[model samples]
Target chain A: MNQIDLGMVDWARAQFALTAMYHWIFVPLTLGLSFLCAFYESLYVRTGKEAWKKIAKFWMTLFGINFAIGVATGIILEFEFGTNWSNYSWMVGDIFGAPLAVEGIVAFFLEATFFAVMFFGWNRVSKGFHLFSTWMVAIGSNLSALWILVANGWMQHPVGMIFNPDTARFEMQNFWEVLFSPVAIAKFTHTTSSSFIVGSLFVITVASWYLLKGRNTEMAKKSILVAAVFGLLSTAYAGLTGDESAYVNASTQPMKLAAYEGLYNGKAKADLVAIGILKGQKAPDDDTDPFLFDIKIPGLLSLLANRDAGSFVPGIKDLVYGNAQEKIVGVKAKMERGRMAVADLAAYKNARKSGDKAGSAMALQKFGVNQDYLGYGYFSQPEESIPPVKLTFYSFHLMVTLGCLFTLFFVVFLYLAYKNSLERHRGLLRLGVVSFFLGLLASQAGWVVAEAGRQPWVIQNYLPVHIGTSNIAAGNVQATFFMFLGLFTLLLLAEVKIMLKQINIGPEEV
Target chain B: MPGYSQNNIFFKWQRTVVRFYLDGFRAMTVGKALWKIILIKLFVMFAILKLFFFSDYLHTNFSTDQQRSDHVLEQITLQSKIQAVEDKK
Candidate 1:
């Protein structure tokens, strides 16, 4: 099978991504709302005011709904690792299994056990105990983020372990290094803060919408103010953490960074294209070739790469193939010949196997004639595969669009919050809806770019994606796919309906 | 509590069976769903079963011995040949 088939991996990745994205709609809210709930609770404790209690209770109700959705969505992700990417699981099980186990035992258990008390045992428990439970829930959520990030971080940087060829796994060599890899830290901070930003914007916008609609003024005021504070902090931190994330990416996966920036030429002073197509003659045609006309960031690439503010970063072309002067020009030609020979052999074999005598003769004739041309197909000593440049180019654009929009939306929201006009500005409230959807878009685009950019490699260089299948029959995957697809679709529809119903009803009923 | 020494074997087995069904039903029905914990327990049980029956099949199938390794390489080569023919157009 070709590397980029929209087959089992595609189906599985799409299914898993769908479920995760659906569930993600709730997770950031759970993280963001839980803190808002706690903050309201703290305010209640200090002021001994009934309004604080009302505010806390209102958001807490919303948090409970979100937390339930998050919990449901999260379960699928855990089981999916073993089911969809079984090879990846077995290969990384030695190193990866630890964090997943810890997440379950330490973070998940802590969250779940206390969440029960916080959600339902308010009357049975003391106020202090209940408050403590809420705080525990917050800690539990963040801790969950921590462990998951640690797992993902390893994928990006692949450190703190030694590859064991015997078992084909990476055995954990240093616990501390695994925990504190630069990529892991940068990713974790950036991811969690981004979630917070998403959460804050979500709450504030909804609250502002309510106020604009004349639904609940006091509720809207408190909600908007609290969410605005968190939103501002998260937005500002996202920029800072994003910078760190970029730096880590530049160091760890330079190719990914290059792809994201559309730096096909890999010039030392790589230009960041504001926009461009990655098709036809636009993309780098050969490793030694330069990209076609493109927009660029003067020296932003160098500044982002080294933080030295002046050092030039190599473009994608340069990264994939070294300087043009260093290239072996005739390599591809040789590679082409080997490929064409194989093709001719295959056609001849197919004709013979099918018992088509005339076809066999014709195929042999074609093979004899094309023998000289085979060299063109296989001249390259080591053939360099480019990403589906169009896909990468478009996915990169989608991600950048969302990023820029998010930056603008949050900046505007923050300014409005500072002006104390969040409740009054209908325009800003509308922007919230736009920003929330944009967050979803950004996350999906990010995944597409990252996964697609890694086109041939399931684990970078060592393993190919096609060879890493589960050995289960394709029928098995098909059967399971239909079953889970139905279930996930039902769950997703129900979740959205329920969430909307809760939002419309408001906390007064509870 | 049911005392072990005095009970008949049938009664003991009946109680164990009853408790098993009850625990399973509770896990399915409980509101504060401890489904994950239950799922893990179930996974371990399945793993034990696999160890007994499926482990040998797995070892034989995926083992990277020379013969299997050669077969895989041949398969990949064949597949690539087909791909090249397709790409020609």
Candidate 2:
């Protein structure tokens, strides 16, 4: 077997993160703008407004530019699974590949088919059929999000699968369980709604720019009105879904919840850290006071996590050290069990080799019993399982704060548009324009928390990232990493240039 | 789309879809020929060509699961191997 190389692991991780981050930049906009285009086209169809058609075509052009780049960024991720994390692919591909195949064969094709009609069939097809095509594009894009998120949600909380000792893999046993996972549902709704908020923010920002320049005033005003109402509705839904996400984290990944709060000590009725600054650098898994000055909301963590204000919320120390009252497994114990699980797999294989059916059965049973803690075995020390708290905490807090702030931005923008006084408040219009980055930041921060917070383990409790890297040289991976970085950066630059050029053309020309 | 095989509805739908696909190919014969090239390239690259380059090292070696896993464990826990080599030196 190939040896584990630390440098290879790091390179593979950096590659995945870089590719995924760039891909996300375009995906959210595509998702949000697809629906927005459909909505605008529907209005055009209903009211027979040439202005609405102009707006629809304008944003649709931007959407096509973004979506085209998204397709380029997207395919690499599927290939990366095999190239970088081949073991992980082989381990869970039976279950994981199903979602990817579904996304490609069904959802992607559906989106592409209707997208052609929506974009090129304006004069060729009937108005009603064109509207239907627009809506189909929206539905198809969202459906694609659903399948991808379901696959990811399985990683956060693997279910509906059983291990096969002989094949040394986890195979799908219940497709429904994988499909309708609670975490997946919550993540899908939360993520897409946040994307919608970003989309609305994008529309408002561009429209605000036009309003400021005093060109296409009617289009700008109409676009802002639609985006504000849409943004407000989706942002509200995001809050509700965000709550569900927190609930899932609190229940399944208590350690991650602790990191989110930057808490180090255990306590019932725990105070939520709304704001704080870390005092000094502390060693990993240390039980010392990690914060200097923390403004707290008493029992809010308990409330947010469990919906019961008095319920116990375990801290980093409790999770890493020990907490008898909370029954926290502590990272060390899980590591031990993880070793036993690995050992059992070895024993099962040995027994099978010797034709000892009963011994193989016993070993298989042991593996089944201990497999839940299997990933911990890959870590030499408990501290390795501890993710960077500062990053996770900051990312999560920014996502929440930005989400709340954008809700207010939408309300204020709506009010301005309604009063026909948006032109009077250039400052607010500029802020509305700035909300685009703020919205994207919030969306990306949410991703950082989700991906970075669940550190060490790529598939939550079952698999560590180090164990999944391909059997390739570190230098080779590094070379490929840089190649991808340069390529994606160039692609992103080209996309932005094309988009800016299209926007310069303005709504009337479109 | 659900297949309604109870009343041969599924067969009818399948026929319609197949006809639509054939008509599309006929309309864009050049594109259709290009698609044939694309499909052949895909088959060769993923299915036929992969077998020559992508050898399963884990399966090829370490006959038992124990041997395979131990090799991984040894790889991860490399400090002992380094220490032993240093002692021998």
Candidate 3:
């Protein structure tokens, strides 16, 4: 209960978000492009085609550029945990740091070792060994993603940890449970598959540029064919995993799900909003209409949430205020219990300091009873539990809409490429170039929905963000935030300049 | 089962891998630029950022692990005490 500095919290949050978003820009491309390189190399190995080797080598160059900058941004992200969010680190580092450490020790080393082999051993190694190296790099990069996502998923839905009153921390109880949590699995699949779509989009974008310019015609067609097919499959897989993520959110973080749908009133047969425009901000339980205009499918939300059209999906108001019929406990009640838990914890510490064993034990027992609602004690009011509705709603909808558009974009390009008439379609080729930016936008929007929608809480029900930040001067965090922004922007510009130069040099040169 | 010939083969394989990397690094085109970027970025991140901007506050302030844990405990428990007094008011 140290007096929280709102400014420090905001600055720290902004710094973390800025670093994460910048890191993400490079990660998805690395995730997908590595596999595409592997596929292209596999084709070269199988067919003994020089063209395929050139294609693989071209993509691999871009991948290497991206991969280097990704590691640069990623290292800083891990350090921020210790610097900006030391409280969260100290509280759950036992569990959270384990996966990240494994990622560095196991996955990173595997990637780094094979990456040297993949890039340098092209002519030196045998065909089989070279292909093996490429595949290893792909697996290693994705494995690195797996561990990072597992740590993030734990934050969103913390499991397999038990709170220790003695240390004032949550200690790991079951490592396997933490690793294999359903939320982690869904998040990994969804995030990595979406990354694959971004990779494919990048390939198609560069290839389409070539087609539009009437250069590298055969190479462009072949590259488009491979990327479109890969993108199509990844889009489908992403869709499936996206559905699983929504279903998991429905149960574990229903307020987030409610915010995504802009639901303020509970309903038995909730309709899923297909497209909507928000009128303005409305408080929970207010009579004002949340949406200015909209279209929706009846009972789809209930079906998505519970796999039953008739099942009730609670909304923001129902979650904020207790619903007797729905058996939903309000945030107000949770806050009360959380306050009791906090008070008892304080009493327990004081009693132990005074050497009153009986009094300490009594307070500890009361604390254990209400420990589940512990994070709620930090909030002053029930409505503090609600995340920004408009942001979450729009981000989720925009991501979904773009996901569908990418699917169609891939299908059309794939058809044109196979038909051997892709060069004739100037307009679609232009769209293909533009679609890469849209893919990046969709990927970023998905993160906004995931992170921004779960506002207030850093560890779901366990800890609020205000309590999780390190005790630091707001000015220090703000200064570092600008420093990182300037540094990352410079690096991003350098990466783009290098990538564009490589693209202009063309695959024939590669 | 192991013999001089087997040991010789293993040594030869290791030498081949080493030679491969050395030759590749020597015969670089774009890779030289990439290596420079990586080195410069790493220097900035570690030398400048880690040295000046970011520090592990708990580790810097507290000498012992126990002291750090105790500090966090104080922060959490102190909040509850303050809130309890406010509730009474």
Fraction of native Cα contacts reproduced by each candidate: 0.01, 0.01, 0.49
Number of the top TM-score candidate: 3
How many clashing pairs per prediction, in order? 20, 0, 1
Candidate 3 has a TM-score of 0.96
Q: Best candidate per lDDT, number?
A: 3
Q: What is the per-residue lDDT of model 2 for residues A304-404, given as tens digits with 9 covering 90 to 100? A: 99999998888777777677777877888987898888788778777887999999999989988998887777667677777889999989989998998
Candidate 1 residue-wise lDDT, A1-510, digit = tens: 333232665566565666566656667667767777888888887788878777787777667656654554565565555555555666677787788788888765778668766766545567788788888988788888888778777776677786542243568999789889998898778777777766776677667667777787677777767776777777678778777876777877666676667665554444566766544654454553333556667777777777765665655555544455634233244345546554664566667668888886776676565443332332222324344555666786786666666666656766776676776677777776566667666655655666566554455443345444444444545655565566556555655666667667776765
Quantify all predictions' global Cα lDDT against the true fold. 0.62, 0.79, 0.88
CA lDDT, candidate 2, residue A238: 97
Model 1 residue runs over 4 Å out of place are A1-6, A275-283, A286-295, A324-385, A388-397, A414-420, B1-89
A423-490 per-residue lDDT for model 3 (tens digits)? 88999999988878889999999999999999978999878887777778899999999999998998
Residues B36-86 of candidate 1 have per-residue lDDT tens digits of 433443454255323332232223556654444333333333555335434
Instruction: State how far residue A205 of model 3 sits from its true place (Å).
Output: 0.5
Q: Could you arrange the candidates by TM-score from highest to lowest? A: 3, 2, 1
Question: Top DockQ: which candidate number?
Answer: 3
TM-score of chain B of each: 0.28, 0.57, 0.71
